[model samples]
Target chain A: MTDNSAHGLEAREDEWLAVRCQLGERAAFDELVARWHEPLWRYVRRVTAEDEAAREVLQDVWVRVIRGIVRLREGSKLRPWLFGIARRALMDRLRERYATPAAVPLQDFDLAADQDTSALEEDLASMQQGLEELPVTEREVLTLFYLRELSLAEVAEVLGVPAGTVKSRLFRARQMLRRDMDTKGRPV
Target chain B: MNQTNPAHPGGSPTLPDVQRLLDAELSLRSRLGYVALLLGSLGMAALAGALWLTEPALPFRTQVAFALMIVIGLSWTVFSVWVLRHRRVLYARQHIVAGRMAVAFTSVFVVSALAIGYGSGKDGAYAAAALGGVMLIGAVLMLLRGHRAFNRLAERRDGLARELGRST
Candidate 1:
């Protein structure tokens, strides 16, 4: 089977599991937890940038998943919905962690206009460092869109932002990463 | 923290631990509670339907049907209201569809009730009652705005799904 068709089938299975779960089937729920736990953990870890916070956020997400599973109609949308819940939980935890009265705006650092093809194709270590240099919002948008391979809309849903906003965030994030690469002076 | 690869952060639980947590927290009691709630509501509805469908062979049978309808309808109202209040996430498409179905049903009922009331010349009271029902319908439709936002998000999801197919 083609990859997309396979994904479609897997999503249908998730939907079936979700319907069974809503009917109070423990085994179905167990399968859901088993299937999604690692990917969710990784997504939450990347988004929150702290293992402890990610763990807490994940617990909250699962609690909500249990409560909200009955309402999820489309199985294909399950992954996006789970990530969206995690993102909201992570935001709540961040708010509580900082106790900051005002929301932090996503930063837009200066973008260097010059092209750096060599830097663009950097070693894994430098790429990791480049990612670390980005703001939390930029990093999250990039990670969800690129590393996690979530569609732009899925990332936008997770972040509770417009698709247009996600596109701009992605563009700016890549630019900032390239700028960081240039500063590190990786050999051409 | 900065040195760590955030993608695979340190100290996160493995798959086994996650399964254990799910097992512990999703206990039998909670699952049973859900099953009981759903089954009870459905049973009441089925009983009401059966009572309504019985042949009107004797006097007071109509009264019995009316009484059963009122009781079952009230029970469903209370149950649904409680469920809605306790629901934490209202953005799911399923919930939206339910809400829309509710609004449509209420609208149809009110219109038919009004037609029967006035067509039979029951006076202005029937119109007044229908207006009250309209207010309830308004409230339900208002709560359904979340569905619109969800649809917008779903559109994006479709786009991404398409993109994934092309890339693959």
Candidate 2:
């Protein structure tokens, strides 16, 4: 099947699950938790870099999802909407930790245009250890993109940013990961 | 990569653990309880306000007491509504159930008030019956809206299931 058709099928399946949950099907909520828990856990675990924090944040994310799903008009957009709630939950936790209003500035990167692309061509799997050292903004974009967790458009929707901004953040994140690896005397 | 941490013996919350955490929020009892609270409070407030307005020779202290009862009832009504809307939200099926409850409660209220009004020959009871009638109409409208919304969602759900080769 073409990518578009595959995506369409996936969207329909997601919508089906969402509609079932909206209809107050107990089994559907179990299915939802079974299906998406690991992916969401990984995302939160990576971002928080703490097992305890990820557990707390993931629970909070599910709470928000359960309470807010009825308000979600377009069920086909469940993937992005779920991630968006996770993002907001993560930000709230981070804000509480740092006692700051703005957790991460989501500004467009002019510096991303100047980063070298040669080192980024290497497999990102080799640089997993370096991901923890990068800033949240860069690490987030890289995690969402490189982990194959979400498509570019889905990532943009989750971040509430333009597709171009997502691309720039990915570029900057890759370069930062490479530089971090190099400084630690690790092979790129 | 192994997502588990050996250091934290119980690394992450398992699926069961997560489900358990969400159980309170998804409790049907809690949702229904809030719905009952909302309807009961509204009914109390409406009756109290109607009596307060219709009784002409009520003492000043009696008027103050009625005003307090109305305020307290309305406060509970607002609290129940907020809890239902935000904390323990009513899903489509729950909405239908709540709507039916509202209709049933209001119908009983209207019937009781009308009987009391005709039997006692009191204007206050008549005023209360009028309020109950208004509530009954609102409840019927709410129930109709809920049914329409549920059917729309169910239709889309069945269509998607068919397209995806799954049972509805």
Highest-scoring model, DockQ: 2
All DockQ scores: 0.11, 0.53
Return the lDDT, model 2, position A100.
Answer: 65
lDDT of 1: 0.61
Grade the docking of candidate 2. Answer: medium
Per-residue lDDT of candidate 2, residues B18-64 (tens digit): 77766877999989998999999999999999999999999999999
lDDT of 2 by residue, A13-126 (tens): 999999999998888898888888877876787788777888899889999999999999999999889989999999999889888655556556664466566555455545
Tens-digit lDDT string for candidate 1 (B1-168): 123333444755655555666665555444334434433453344334433444344358676765676577558656655654354223244445445555654555457546766787553436434553764466487546646655655554445446555220
TM-score versus the correct structure, for each prediction: 0.53, 0.92
Runs in model 1 deviating more than 4 A are A1-7, A101-126, A185-188, B1-9, B30-168
Candidate 2's displacement at residue B137, Å, is 0.9
Q: List the residue pairs that clash in candidate 2.
A: none
Top-scoring candidate (lDDT): 2
Candidate closest to the true structure, highest TM-score: 2
> How high is the lDDT of residue A78 in model 1?
80
